[model samples]
Target: MNNRAARVALALICGAVFGFGLSLSGMMNPIRVRGFLDIFGAWDPSLAFVMAGAVGVATVGVRIMRHLSRPVLDTEFHLPAARRIDGRLIGGTALFGIGWGMAGFCPGPALASLPLGLPAVAAFVVTMALGMTVHDRLVVRSK
Candidate 1:
């Protein structure tokens, strides 16, 4: 009914759509991801199209958002303006890449594929959540 409620609803819908898309695109499969990551092996290039589509959609959405006078729910847009590269940013990105490369599944895909009842996917999701909690409590707190 209110603007904030509408925004929240929209966000939920968007997230559901994204998760569905990831599932539909086979991005939730670690095997598929691993295949894509494997350069010399049986390389699966399907995820490239998914990544490209997402980037295109995000670019357009960002442009549209920037052109808007103000956010529908909030008085100001909550956009990150950090242009400087810092150690935390680099280290976090490297860590994320290493984990993704090693496991062949990121958080979204791991959670999305949990319905398949794969033990590895389940374990990856659980460990990732635990790592996030620990990072939040220790690394974030210490900073």
Candidate 2:
């Protein structure tokens, strides 16, 4: 297959695996997510395990990938080059935390939940796209 097709195939497979993991781990359930976020209330520690496992696996994967000269599907692993935490990063992180705490749905879980045909999921996805578009426009204008 061609490079673009290979990239698409890899993305599809990875996305399917990620969505399945989220569903299986109960991360796609907003109630569970909200419960995890509720530290002072009836907090659930289940998602913490999921997150820990994800982080551990990602850490190992990155380490292993670093040993490779090139990626399996690309010329190089296009990792982020930035090292400093700027105001934009802080502001974006705060906004993401606020949104996640309020809606109990981050981008990954929100997109995965779309197949359930829930109105809230659909609304969240729509708003997320609008926010992304707005951010892109603002960045372009600033540049």
Please tell me which predicted candidate would have the highest TM-score against the true structure.
Answer: 2
What pairs collide in candidate 2? none
Winning candidate number (lDDT): 2
Model 1 clash pairs? none
Put down candidate 2 lDDT per residue, 40-116, tens digits, no spaces. Answer: 99999999999999999999999999899999888888889989999989998999999999999999999999999
Q: RMSD per prediction, one decimal?
A: 1.8, 1.1
The segments of candidate 1 whose C-alpha lies over 4 angstroms from its true place after superposition are none
> lDDT of all the models against the reference?
0.89, 0.95
Q: Whole-model lDDT for model 1 versus the true structure? A: 0.89
How many collisions per candidate? Answer: 0, 0
For the record, the alpha-carbon RMSD of candidate 2 to the native fold, in angstroms, is 1.1
Candidate 2 local lDDT, residue 126: 100
Candidate 2, 9: how far from true, in Å? 1.8
TM-scores for every predicted model: 0.87, 0.95
